[model samples]
Target: MKKIIYLLILTLFYSCTVKYYGYVYDIDKKTPICNVRIKTIDSLNITYSNENGCFEIKLKEKVKELVFEKENYQAHNLRTLSIQSGEFMKELPFGDTIYLISKNSKYSRPKTTLPNNVYKK
Candidate 1:
């Protein structure tokens, strides 16, 4: 009985997660950007990049934006994010894939050209 309880506890702890992954880039270098700060628009949750320019955060519902910032790189705001996975919402998944690019102190990123219903005024 003790062994079984121990196994159950281990499984429960290992099965939990609280973050999603994201990619960052530099437009001029056309390369993966490292050391950038990424956070929820609410300024509550935040994270930074790994060597591969990837990051993760576990956020609950009600998050409105994901902000990115770096020195020598303009700040970028990504809005209208919806993590509508239904049963899969707890899987710690990423939203729309974004490629942030910057040039001459300006920034641009690829987003769904089509209109998004999540847009807010």
Candidate 2:
């Protein structure tokens, strides 16, 4: 009976894993970015940030890298993240935020451009 109980406890302890919550923010504005896309580097798994710029992704086996992107923001490729799985509810440092650069001009001009000579007098 002791041997059976020990085996069950060990199996339960080693079988635990957790999905982490991630957040996306604008690097320059320091604000949350909504509707952002998130994907794994080595797999087809993909997820998106909600209105609050937060997302949760389950690590596929041992994948530790994710790529984030949105329409106007430059894609933020997160590589080589330090992963600590098996914790039921571990608190992550400020490292959960992924910063992204804007693809638009510094002036935040509209992405559209008029055809040549359209602005000609």
Candidate 3:
């Protein structure tokens, strides 16, 4: 009886945690973006993409939101619920591809020429 109860508890604990695997990429370039930060919005769980842009994060089932960030790129927010709503791919083992938009592409300004007199030391 004790062994049965222990097994049940172990199964419940294991089922409470979920692992999400995916790769990050540049939206415009269609190339992998390495070192992107992935974190749970409501928890301390965090991980980073590798040189190949592959990453895996283990989060509690209760965590509904994820935030992805990187330098010079726009931050992306993903809701777990969207996956169930068919907004995101349902595949797990094969993983998903997350695209990030470069900040420069979104907010580029025209260059202005400066006067030569301003170059005086």
Candidate 4:
């Protein structure tokens, strides 16, 4: 009776979903940073952080690498993070707080830094 109800609730809470929530903010101000591009490395799924600097995306089970970029901010690379089977929500913080200042001309960009957030076809 009560045991069955508890199991049902637990199952419902742990069900897998194809959604992810992400956010970007100023390193110093802590204010929401809007218009950050969220590009899926492998697929064509693309999104932008809203004014509140938050975004939600749907993806299959795989490593997801989310890139946070802005015009004036120094581009910060974040490694792909894994999400659990029963848990669909995951948060990825950059190795260090990203401060976007002037651009670096001597920087060499890599073709790919992290694996795509979905399974390979």
Pick the TM-score winner. Answer: 3
TM-scores across all candidates?
Answer: 0.56, 0.59, 0.65, 0.50
Candidate 4 residue-wise lDDT, 31-98, digit = tens: 78788776677647777778987776566553456566778676665555656787765666533333
lDDT of each: 0.68, 0.72, 0.81, 0.63
Better of 1 and 2 by TM-score: 2
Candidate 2 colliding pairs: none
Q: Number of the top candidate by lDDT?
A: 3
Instruction: Encode model 1's per-residue lDDT on 1-121: one tens digit a residue.
Output: 9999999999877667445676786766667788888888778888887777777777655455678888867688865345575533323346434556564534553444756765866
Q: Give the CA lDDT, 0 to 100, for residue 47 in model 2.
A: 84
RMSD of each: 8.3, 9.6, 9.0, 10.9
Candidate 4 — number of clashing residue pairs? 4
Candidate 2 lDDT by residue in tens digits, 1-121 = 9999999999876666446577888877888988888887754888888888898876535455678879977776765446356544434443478878787637344558779999898
Count: clashes, candidate 2: 0
